[model samples]
Target: MLSRKNLEILVAAQKRLYCTFPELPSFEQRWDFETDGVIQALLTRLGDNDPYFHPRYAGHMSGYVCDVAVMSYFLAMQFNPNNHSYDGGRATTKMEVECLDSMARMLDWNHYQGHLTSGGTIGNLEALWIHREMGANTVICSKGAHFTHKRAANILDLKYLEVDVTKDGSLCSIALSGLLAALEATDVPVVVCTLGTTLNGAIDPLDEIFSLKAEHDFKVHVDAAYGGYFYLIRARLAGRNRKAFDFLPAADSIVIDPHKHGLQGFGCGALLLRGVSESTSQAIYTHDSPYTYFDRRGISIGEKTLECSRPGAAAAALWATMQCLPLEEEGEFSRVLLSCHTAAVKMSELLFAVDDVRLIVREPALDIVVFYIECADISAATRQLYEQLKASGFYVAMADCDISSETGVFREVSCIRLTLMKKEHLAMVDELADQIIRLSKCIADEYRSQYQAL
Candidate 1:
């Protein structure tokens, strides 16, 4: 599935970069026979990985990196610039700023400050760190938020609270309001709203959350790590989903992962701050090295970020990809995102037609579709179906959903999860739906036969 043309482009770009630095002496790098053998062995070992790049691999949040991103990353690696300071990566640092500017505009932020990070986890950590510096002692998030938020709160020594989710896996606004009102009596709270949840891709009601913010004195941080880019396609999204992105501009901080939906390779996440001041930016200040920031007069990324020595290749990859697919409404990238949503809706329709399949969410908020098998032992049947689908070359993932009983008890039920992230999935939705039905029937038949034998 890799592109040979992109590889050639990378080679050409590397040569051009080398020619630009003719004043520097060139050194010949020599490798022994053992090095070649080890490299070959490593490639063989990596071959065992599942085919995440193919259309059939709709298992997780992983999406295919575009050719331009791959080529740009490969070309950038030739120099391996560190984006910590301008002294280390003058060109890449500027590229990162421009990339952030594009993303900020995409989110409809008039004025913002942001920097790239290793991934969503660190991006969230840094945002929360800033919240702590603002004197917020407690962090609140929905139960459906990414697990990293709670872990980050613990690491930062702040009080972490999880509000219950509604039946649709959205943050329960009633519960959140009560918590915020109770907490407001004592300490300031920083609410972490998840734009898209991991399990079912459910979106928390950000509009309601913002309304709450008006009543109480609290900061709002949006963890749009998986769903931020959907802002470009908001017009095509379901009404409920579109409302979430509408309130994105009101957030104090936002975390987005370019690696997930930005058509770039891994190790690229961003944290955008709205209406940040010089004092707020100085909350993450660090002592500079004499060797670094000598030439730069303004704010360095290292001074305001939690990480140092971040890869410039990630910046190059994102910059190149954005250049080809600009983040604009009804653009090529937005159309691809809309295609993912359409494909997901198609998958949901197929599951609804099946008698034995029970949808976790009637309609997906984004590209992820989740459903469980209807059987006496639902967990076992769902697990069997997951394994059967993989064996049949239809890869998918699984999650556990809590079902509440009339007696006020909860039970965990295993469910199948499909993330229709690849653009090619738009064309394969029908085939994928057929495969799911056939595989599910086969697994159900096997289960019945085994039950009769028992």
Candidate 2:
């Protein structure tokens, strides 16, 4: 009787869902069934409800048409291929491999090996795990690297050294050299440089750090989940027949996220490794279950991967999206990526021009701009600004206190971070600029009134 009641409830819910479909003009709907609104709505809801998902919830996120990714996510769900084994879904995993290879080539290490993980954090963890397991006792990065990098190091029980960054939020090469000299001969150090920071998308000096690989035998891993796509843009604008363009050579291993730049849905990140020999990534498993092993090796994917049973939908979506985007002349991703960088520059210009609000990063390394108002009481003003901006329906990020504190800028500076990914985001920047000006004036008036009352 309870099962029957639940069935009835389910049927009623389905009926309610059906009522939400948009009514369209008959002729257009008949001619363009692909643009059907009902199908799009269904896909959007599925993406929001799925496990291992980042819910967009009708709010602007990272200046992306997240709804589009949601559509791809659901569209790929139809096949439901298990990409664990070639025997089961060889075609799907092969497509995933091709997508991974495209990313590898972009990083300038065609020989690199990698696999898609859940997200950037997972990608970072996998890279660190591989590096640590191979033999890296100590890790080094700028104070501005993402929290996940530090968290991954802590999980591995590894000690990490953080160097100070310049005012532009780049790692100081001189500071890094000094730290290396200070380290004892017995100390083991592996430099993990950030290609793009999370809070403000500040790119560390890749060329300088990579040059150190010759002086020191330490391995270099790039956390390029936020800035890897920038290299492709730099190559494109240089034009044909240009010799020796400025770009970071692919490190020993680098983390890239499809969800961030590849325009695919979330839960898609790859860790490209320069020298991923069989010994470094050999599959070692004790569980000898004959039932699970159907492939040539007869080994389950769980043995090779950190997570068991990763969704094939994410891999499929990534493969499909990469197919849609064509590569550039020098074998890089599409020029559309450069548009995102340009939007970021425009936004930065608008933000810097605002009265009293100072740009934290004057020139952005990627599609991120960070700025703050100069005030004596930074905390109170920042809190007020954050609230006002949020209430205005503009989604921006604040710098982490711990990271800023270590960099010697936390107390003196509290800034907001913006990522420009969508072209529509450019129209909104003027409005944001106006809001900042209004917010600064409001803070000044409040402070002045308090002084007079005192």
Candidate 3:
């Protein structure tokens, strides 16, 4: 939970910051510091936004950025440092490297290489691009893979193939095995595994696929953009999901979003390479950026990364967040994450007790819980309920693609996917559950005649 204390500290910091600089005569001409008119304008604009920090906002991945990260970002934003090179952001660049080193060590990668990207998409683009640069012919990912995989393949002009997924929305290991066997023995394809599919939060079978990689001679890349941090609590996950994260060390490259589950605001993602070997040196280069590398101590992050002019403030925010919530299994961070998972489990139990709503996945694999009204027309009903829930102060996300059950209980249908990410949600579980249970019954009752005819 947040407090007014953070605001007080920020105010104090702002006062100290002003004392560091001589006030310019033109500073008075700048917008009023705390004008009622300006404050009202901000309130009017930002108040209309979805209550992302609220427990009622079970919607989307736009969860709350913790107080430390938010305060750190605002404080660093004043400096407006660019992380492209040390010439631009010396302190922040060092902070970024240290953060990357800590994350690499968390995944058990000793001699790993990494750099922060603008976000997950570019981070993923670089990972697959590295494999392509290594002369891999094809990039294969599950049908449940993020939409970015195919686009990244297209951007790189590499052959892209998609394997089917299992009933629970996970990548089908059997299908992947067959696909690998059919590929030419000499074909060392780069297989992309999604640790958390955006829609249902399904984890690909990484451990199962690792065995196939050795037998078939393929490189593995993991897109743990949303689920990467969950590796810390693998023991708390369901069997398959836990097993998949257990083999995270085997992946050649990994992309993770600090913004998603790493307790930061938008646009902070990282790419982790196993090691900068002779073969992968093509991807990581540090020759001589005459313009940006003046008096550079070591390799500039811009040299190793595809994107230039990344934000140094992002590094500052994440670094501050890590200080408060160290990436340890038994730390405060993991406890908060576990509480989120518990909210999802508790939500599932509550929905299960409800009369007519059908849960897409029998149980949530992660903090995301997907469920829908069991009506004749799910598309119509789900859209209706999505808006209705929002109006009633219970925001939830709509699925990207249609969901169905294996036994044909629920056909191709739109569903509600709630990202129970905030720890405050644990307290709201019963109220949220009651809200859905009561509304779901109403939605179901309205379509009862149509249901009986079917």
Candidate 4:
């Protein structure tokens, strides 16, 4: 199920794009060998991949690209613009600026300097690199934050520290305050706040974290790669979540991935710096390109980005998608996000009602629901249930969680994680929940039988 309308539009748009350069003499270059059998083999090989486009594939953060974005990307691929410099892709460079502006506006940023990257990992790396250039030695983040933060710190050769997270998998504000209070005299260069965690989709208390900046001299960088688009649906979010979105603009820098919730394909992540001057970026990232930057005297994207040869098609697709969807609270895009969150909430309710299941979080903060099978050996039962579900045509993911017990000790637990990213998932929530409950019981019974036999 792909959209036929998008296919037609892409073909028509590609023809128009070709017609734009009529002045150039056209020459036909044809391949000498026959390619029909090889092409069929390639298609057969690609079909072996998982069905991530289907609504039943709620396993991970992989999302289906919108039809408009797909069409726009295909149309731009006819030109294959490289966004390293204006000379490489003049029209797409302007599109990248407009796309970055739209993202900044969504975060309530008035004045900012930003550009798109290949993905969140590189975007976060650039944010930390900027902090390192500003003479900061320590990088701090929640334990639940993406693992890239620590790796990025290592790459930057800076000291790294992790704050504890609460039972809900969110960074504990009290623990963070304690850590900062102890390091009151130290220079903690960057404090990375994760807006949406990888495992449970937990959002740290950004407002409280930013409040600590009053006493500490650290720059706050928000990793909103997965949850940044949730800002557009603030009207439907819980109070705490809404408050977190409200504090987004206070960050010194932020990373948001257009490929995630922005309904675009992969290789689109953005880094936004608030009130950063051109001189500072020039000092850090500026490099002399002998042949590329000759066309423009002003700052090219190549001078500001950590990467040199980014895809201009990514920018074209994002700009076209934003033009059609628009980042507004009452827009169709916001409603789609709301539906994803609603599906998670509904799934959580269904899990709560089942005696054999236990939710990792009281409720889903975003569109991810995580729960474990209740059994004598929870880890085994959960794994068994995960495999059973997969075998039964329902693809879901698994995560290892740290659970706090009544004795003030932490235990490792394996949990089944479901990300309701597709809008069509809203209709499958009830059936999915019922399937989980039934499979969990079967797994639990099988485990009990084996224990008795032992």
- Report every candidate's CA lDDT: 0.85, 0.65, 0.85, 0.86
Candidate 2: stretches off by over 4 Å: 1-69, 235-247, 283-289, 297-303, 327-335, 400-413, 452-454
> Residue-wise lDDT of candidate 3 within 1-454, one digit each (tens)?
3569999998898777666657644243355365888888998999888888877888899888899888888888887888887878887898899889889988988898889998889999988877877778799999888889899989998888999998778899999999988987556699999998898888999999998866688889999999999999999999988999999988899999999999888899999998558555743454565576674575567877888898899999999999889989999999988998888888898888776877877788888898888766777888988888888888888874555543255445678889998888899999888888888888889888666777
Off-target runs (Cα >4 Å) in candidate 1 are 32-34, 286-288, 297-299, 404-410, 448-454
Candidate 4 structure quality by residue, lDDT tens digits, 1-454: 4488768777787778767778998745599878899999999998997788889899889899888888878778768888888888887889999999988888777889999999999999999999889777888899999999999999999889889998778889889888877774556568899988999899998988878778777788999999988988866878887888889988999999988988888899999998578788779886777877877744468878889999989998999989998888888989999999999999999889887778889789999999887666777777888888888889999888876533233467788999999999999999888899998878878777887999
- Candidate 1 lDDT over 18-81, as tens digits, reads 7877888986577655687889999999899888888889888888888888888888887888
User: Which run of 10 residues does model 2 get worst, by summed lDDT?
Assistant: 50-59
**Best candidate, lDDT-wise?**
4
Cα-lDDT of candidate 2? 0.65
Superposing every Cα of model 1 onto the true structure, what RMSD results? 2.1
For model 3, give the 10-residue run with minimal summed lDDT.
Answer: 23-32
The root-mean-square deviation over C-alpha atoms between each candidate and the true structure, in angstroms, is 2.1, 9.7, 2.9, 2.0
Q: What tens digits encode model 2's per-residue C-alpha lDDT throughout 1-454?
A: 1246545654565455455445933331145446568888897887663122221111222424233344445645655666665555555677767877777666566576677788789888877787788777788889888778789889998888899988767678789888887887866787877766776666677667766666666878888787776666665432310111243554777787777777766677776777768655774223455665467743234446665566677776777666666444343344556665666677677766765566766666666776666555556776788777767665566663322332245543556666666545555656766776788778857766776887
